[model samples]
Target: MISSRGRKIFVAIAGAAVTIVALLCIFPFWMVVIGSLTPENEIYVRGYSLWPQTFSTEAYKLAFEDPGKILRSYLVTVGITGAGTAVSLFIVSMCGYVLQRPDFKSRNFFTMFVFFTVLFNGGLVPWYILMTNYLHLKDNYLALILPMMVNVFYLIIMKNFMRSIPGALIESAKIDGAGEFYIFLRIVLPLAKPALASIGMFIALNYWNDWRNGMLFMQDETMYPLQYYLYRLLSSLDFLKSAAASTIDLGDQVFPSESFKLAMTVVATGPIILLYPFVQKYFVKGITIGAVKG
Candidate 1:
């Protein structure tokens, strides 16, 4: 019903807005990619540019040349993420299912207990001392996995979602001679796929990106995860000095620090980027279900 001129104007404004937002989201990634390809000297002299002035594979080559460290870090991250996600999901889903049951006498008390921890955390110093002295998880991979096993926010969201399911369904399963665990695993979990998927991705991202635990607990170079390793490489002048010092005999084959950092960023981010599309549907579905119900 609009005039041709008005329709054109509306289309132009909408297209311009979309283009601006898209560019804002995409420009940093584009810069990182271009920076990775750029020569170190050019980057150092000229600063970051929208396009690489002089392209080179030296950064990627350096990253892969002694890929042993990077590969080991990747394996550690993958293992932690996989194992942590599985264990945490199991625990969260089970706890949430129980808490959601209307007849569970202690459900209100238990929910308040969890909600209390969200607002009041044991401070960092005491927690650190406990892990190091009593728990003795220092320099251990379990330090990464065990500490983050349950997120209260995720638990609450899941419990609320589970509440939306009919109580008659649980009663019917119980009448069929199903035990609590059996009903939870066989009946509840199958119906809670959307919530599980969303929480799973959240847990996976947490485990994958975790470096604070690694930095605090891990002293051994071999125990370092990818992010912590990259952190040390980027932040420590002594570490870079030692690396460059060790390679001094190679003469003109020095590590490209700037470019290599960009390459590492790409490596660290690549898997999650690839994984987003597959898990995104579940994420949206889970949020919608939880939000609408609670």
Candidate 2:
């Protein structure tokens, strides 16, 4: 057994390591918040500040000057995130449950096929042409949702977690004459909550952050997701400049290109922060269980 001195040293080292990592993770976000709140002039002169001398809301005002656009983007993003996550989770969980069954034939072949996609992929040109030409997913919500709805990595995570479920539970359910679907819905799902939550969060984040589909397929401002809207705002300096001209008097208010970028980061990140606490409870157990191999 280790003595008290050794234990204390271990604790101290671990605490320092964690503290450093936590700061590294948190400092960038803190800067984004501070920079968003900082006056444009302050950011220009001083670069990003941990603490600002002067605070301003002009950036936010400019962001929301197009309230209709922002609101529509918010709705689109929320719809995609909600629907995509639900459908993805259901598909992933079903595939996972089926693959974990010992009685299943062709499981190995399918699993390897799924895993192969993870390692190699058809080129971007083919993928783009296939989605746009063959599938005709463009100019629609399906364009956004379909691409992200089923993920191989997430499927594998769910499969591993389901594989760890006791075989006796399945046998007992069978003995009681429960169908596979009934047993899956009733028995497996409840036991797989942690894994589901973990993978569900990943899927949600993907849909939320996805701007490529919007940029690629969506010509309609009405269909712009929040991330894509924010992307457009950042890339077009003239838009930000003009937005500033309309909102704040040009002489008094500086147009915040630098600060606007940070403000966009702040706005884009707010929902994730608000939603995280709800799922934070599942993270540790879900990540741990999913990490363990069957």
Candidate 3:
């Protein structure tokens, strides 16, 4: 064992290292907050500031001048994120369980099939055609939800995690006359929480942040997800203001484009910030276990 001096030295070095890393991670977020709150004139005169010289809510005001659409977008995103994560998690868990079963023949073939999709794919043109023409998902919520429901990488991780669970558990359940579905529901589902939570968060984030599908398929103003709406606002601030000008009276106020972007960044990222901490332990553990599960 190390002596007291060595231990103290180690602690000092570790503390300094962690503080540095923490600053690196947090500084950008702090800047986002500071920039969002800073007055537009302050930003124009002197780029970004670590701390706002003049605090103002003009950014948030410009963003939410028409709160109806923003609220609708929130509803759309929340609905999809919740529904997609639940459905995707259930399907992925079942797939993982099936692939882990010792007696399951053709599991190798199916695994290869799944993995092959990851390595090569039809071009975006064909994929877009399939989604729009055949699936007819254009101007639909399914366009955003269905394409990302399963990830090959997450499925393989789940398979490994399930495999590492002792076979005796399955054998015991079988001996007790539990049906396959029953065994999966009562036994496997409860035990797979860490892996489930990990992949579930990933799926949720994907659905929450998805905009490309909306950009590609959706044409209706009512159907825009939060990210997609914000994306349009970021792309063309003048268009946003001009469009809103008729509905809401801007009066003498200018749109807070710079600060508005930062504000949108905060709003778009808020839920994940609240969410990730709670699942962080499970996420880290699940990844570690999967990596070494063989």
Candidate 4:
């Protein structure tokens, strides 16, 4: 019903808006890439540019020269992310399914218990002392996985999504002589794939990006995760003071610290950036399911 001129104008405006937003998001990343490839001396002299005036692989070479540390950290991060996601998804999904069941007695009380923790957390000092002194989890990988096992907000979102499933489905499953665990594993879980995938990615990203836990609990440099290793490298000038310090002499090692920082940032972010597209559909679907159901 619109005139040809008006339709063209509307399309042009929308296209321009999208282009502007896309450029805003992409320009910073481009700058980082250019800056990282730019020689350290050149960056100091010429300042930042969209294109590297003198491109060099020095930063990447320094980063990967003794790939042992980075490789170990990658293994630790992968293990934590995979294990944590599986455990967290299982616990949260099961809890959420039970919480959403209409006939479950004391469900309101259980929900409140979970929700209350979100509002009022135990203080940091107490948590640190408890984990380190009481639980004796310091320097252990469990410290990374156990503390973040259940996120209340995610549980609430999953519960809300589960509530949207027809009660008749669960009732029929029950009548078919299926146990609760069997029903959950076989029927409910399959239907909850979108929510599970979204929450799984959320948990995995948390584990992968976790540097604070490593800093707090892991005293041994060898146990340090990738983010923590990168953090220490970026912040500390005397990188020889920590793990793998003895591998390179302070006098002989020539590290482009600034470019190295940028390079590490790119490496740490690369996985999630690649993963976002694949998981984006589930994320959208999960949010829509939660919003409509909750």
Off by over 4 Å in 2: 1-14, 171-177, 241-254, 292-294
Question: lDDT tens digits, residues 1-294, model 1?
Answer: 569989999999999999999999989999998998999889888987998777987777766656777777788889999999999999999999899787899999999998898889889999999999999998899998888899988898889878877889989999999999999998899998878888888888889889999999999888888788778877985664443324334457445788877877787788878888898887787667657444
> How well does each candidate superpose onto the true structure, as a TM-score?
0.90, 0.83, 0.86, 0.87
Candidate 3 lDDT by residue in tens digits, 215-281: 9988997899889988887788674554342455656866556887888778777777887788788
lDDT of each: 0.84, 0.83, 0.83, 0.83
Number of the top TM-score candidate:
1
lDDT minimum window of 10 residues, candidate 3: 239-248
TM-score of 1: 0.90
lDDT of 2 by residue, 1-294 (tens): 578889999999999999999999989888889889998887778888789998898778777765566677889999999999999999889998898788999788889988898889997899999988998877889999998887887888888888889999999999999998999999999998878888888788889999999998888777888899888877888754543436445565455688777776677778889878887877666567666542
Candidate 4 per-residue C-alpha lDDT over 79-185 given as tens digits, one digit per residue, 9 for 90 to 100: 98899999999999999999988889989999999899878988899999999999999989999888889998889988987877888988998999999999999
Pairs of residues clashing in candidate 4 = none
RMSD list, candidates in order: 2.6, 3.3, 2.9, 2.9
TM-score of the candidate numbered 4? 0.87
